[model samples]
Target: MLSISSTRQRQPFTVLILICLLLLLPTSLPFLLPPPTTRPSLPTLRSPPRRSPPLPPSSSSSSSSTSLSSSPLDPLLSLSTLASVILIHELGHYLAARTLNIKVSEFSIGFGPKLFSFTRSIINNKMNGEEENIEYSLRVLPIGGYVKFPENYNSSLVMEEELKGREKFKEKLNVEKNEKGILGMFEWLNEEEEGVVKKKVKSGSKPKITTPPKEIEYYTDPNLLQNRRPRDRFIVLSAGVVFNFLLAFILYFGSVLFGPGLLKTEINRGVLVTSEPIPYSPSSGILHKGDVISSFNGVNLLKLPSDVNVIEKEISEIIKTIKSTETGNEIEIGRGSERITIKPSLAVGRSYPTIGVSLSPNFSGVSKIKTRNVFEAVKLSVQEVCKVTKSTTKGLASFFESILPKFGGGGGGGGGSISGPIGVIKLGSDVIGQKDWSALINFAAAISINLGVVNALPLPSLDGGQLGFVVLEKVRREKIEQRTMDDVNAIALFGILILSVGTVFSDTMRLFGK
Candidate 1:
């Protein structure tokens, strides 16, 4: 019976391992396959466009090109990037606690059983003859990390005991009146106390309490997280969110400054028409090559004349609206310097209208917008981060609103609406396969921003939840009972478990095309 129970417990981990193996193995196939003998020729019919001769490859360029061509199934790079970002977030909390003189008992990356661990002694004068050892560990699972602190009541009791012992020693030495003075003013000590102090001073012994019974310092002796001021605790709680946001902003800045050329338009031109009209198509006579499309169905193509922001989004919306319609639509084009309006009729038996003209694949007449200086990049990055944050917040709210109703209805049609770990891995694999640094970097930045925003939410089991408890304690001017805190934490854990299970189920359904 026990064996059966243990096997059941291990099944989820076994399945997870299998899933990871399946997801990663296919990506490595390209590495095993032979390299191409020569560059593949482009498809004919249009007569492939002319290209510039290849430049000589330097060492750095060669390595980068190789990386670009590497198999998309290689999960190492993406996984490592994610792990590093999470580690930095946790480090923010650790650093803040250490800065505030609060003792952190353990610092660990990941969850579950410890895979490896090491201890480091922290020697400080405030430790009161106690040795402070911090244990750093890496755990089996890489989902998240934590910094553990001594229990508040235990730490307070130990500190009170230590203070009592110090007071007793002062009484024994008859130097209670000298408490206000520096240690060097030992003149108030009686002969016996003076002799004892001299012998100890000569021996370079640590400060001792001679009156009370001797006691060994325990784990609770050091000043702990709860002993810090409220503001300091708040900082410690919020530092992870701050670090995640900082990482996201840095990634955004890098993607803009160093990524592929940003899509833009020429000063007075729109998207230049490139392809000749298709035969018997809606645009056969009305549309022609070299016509720049400036608007579609009464909507202007450019939201901002000079800025490239929203260009892709507007274009996508326009295409979606056009494809959804079953009738003709108006298109405004720039021919030379003249603006002309044309009505494109729907092709026979097709649902959407067709102009039959193709946009320039190379963006021939359009401009590539690149940051000219670091200041502009920084400013743009900030704006991008703010925009992402707002959009993510709204999305999360909508997701919750949609899912909460399904919980009671027993419905199962949200498979495509949300993503879990499996979905994320699949998406990451796709991005990696594309071998585009800009896309990968932008994806990473989005994930980082999501992490920051999600963690900032006032939900139980999250950093913001901890901050909420701190705020409650401050308001009540009393510590919450340990039992109550435990109950809250347990409830939070259970809620997370339910959410995770549902999300994983949804992801699986999507994976199987349900």
Candidate 2:
């Protein structure tokens, strides 16, 4: 049997460094790849015409600014939101453990040096009046948090420390002697004399009393996590993700019902140009930012069938029109009051035909709908959670799917939009800086859902991984060796850290538009 203390010892720094390097190798690939101009061209077409019609420009600028600039307090607010999510996650586990009559030794937010700490004595009526002293602490780092149980500790070491702490507490309570100079000296002398006189006939003789050392007690409560039934352990392990989902649901429900309602946008105009295109691409230098693409190949975008997939349909139609023509496709864009027409053809890239531009749905109008119907709100929240979870799961899967091939000499990588803690904070800050607090609420809910989905992945060291172990134990009808499980967990944790670092690197790259 391996004690949890020994199992949690820091892993080799070299091994972690190696893993991080391996994981981050893909992120450094952009630097090695040839620049856009130097890359081999797959398909090319003649330069197209550009015309600005004598018409009033489109005033399609919405309230939201496209700038991603950050304010001073934006990062702080984002960090606070992240901390709140983590705290809620830990609280889920803590509450579940307590509900199952499990003794929690500590509940801590964050890691590293402690900022504030306190001990709470909780009386468990089911444990024969046993008082559980749980130490709760807030640390400096806001990265993560945890809940600890006595079952995870070395019994002997814990007992020794408890005894030492108790002794120190008693020493603090007793008044110091001889600290007041002459007055204190007089009090000490009087106390010594009184002690000697009370002993009787003990002049110049000290009466020594010795008591045997107290025996240390170990906690053998059956309610300890490892001692509990497999089902109970499963609940405790899965509770974190469950709480994350619940938090997302609550936020969505509150926002949709009580807040400014849900934002409903109709894309009756055209797709908005989100960012600049890569250099030398078809749309490069031609389609400027804030341009509304009103039509493609003489087809009006407003005439397209409207639905949830309308944006995707429009994009698909645009691509189809580009590929269908060798004489270049006509593109009508609305920029302020001017109606501009540009003929640009698509270029074949390493993967697919691309114009090297990003586009999003251009809203014709925006409205908010508030409903007092509880059932409607509940339905909407549930739908939102499920949709987010499904998309997050797919995105996570695709990211790995894309990156795994890079390890096998595959040229391209990084398919889906992935963000780590740092990326999320930056995004949250940007939303706040834009003064769109409603979007921030929705962003928080989305983040919560993402957290839940990621933690529920059974790739080791996560909640889902732990739940898998419990199931395995139940099937085997025996417990796995703690050392073996610890080793697996350590490896998995290192992998997670490497992945996090890689994501941060990716986020940084994206921030710089690399």
Q: What lDDT does the true structure give each of the candidates? A: 0.55, 0.60
**lDDT per residue as tens, model 1, 1-514:** 0000111121111122223434532111000000010001111222223333332233543356323554744466656555566667777788887887777777877666889999999786666656778899888866446667655454345546868987876674565436544344455667777777767867888546355433433334336665566687789888888988898788767755775423222333244455678897666776666555665555555433533223433444555554555455555554434566656667667545656665532232222234758899898888777866765665566467656768778432222134555555555565566555554565566667766776677865567776888899899998665435545755764575556565556556767877
lDDT of 2 by residue, 189-305 (tens): 357654554454335453332223334343456877867889998998888889989998998788678765544444444566766777887767777655666666555665556
Lowest lDDT block of 10, candidate 2: 29-38
Name the best candidate (by TM-score): 2
TM-score of each: 0.55, 0.65
Full-model lDDT, candidate 1? 0.55
In order of listing, the candidates' clash counts read: 1, 5
Q: Give the TM-score of candidate 2.
A: 0.65
Q: Cα miss at 465, model 1 (Å)? A: 1.1
Candidate 2 clashes between residue pairs 3 or more apart in a chain or in different chains: 56-337, 57-336, 57-337, 57-338, 58-336
lDDT of 2 at 447: 70
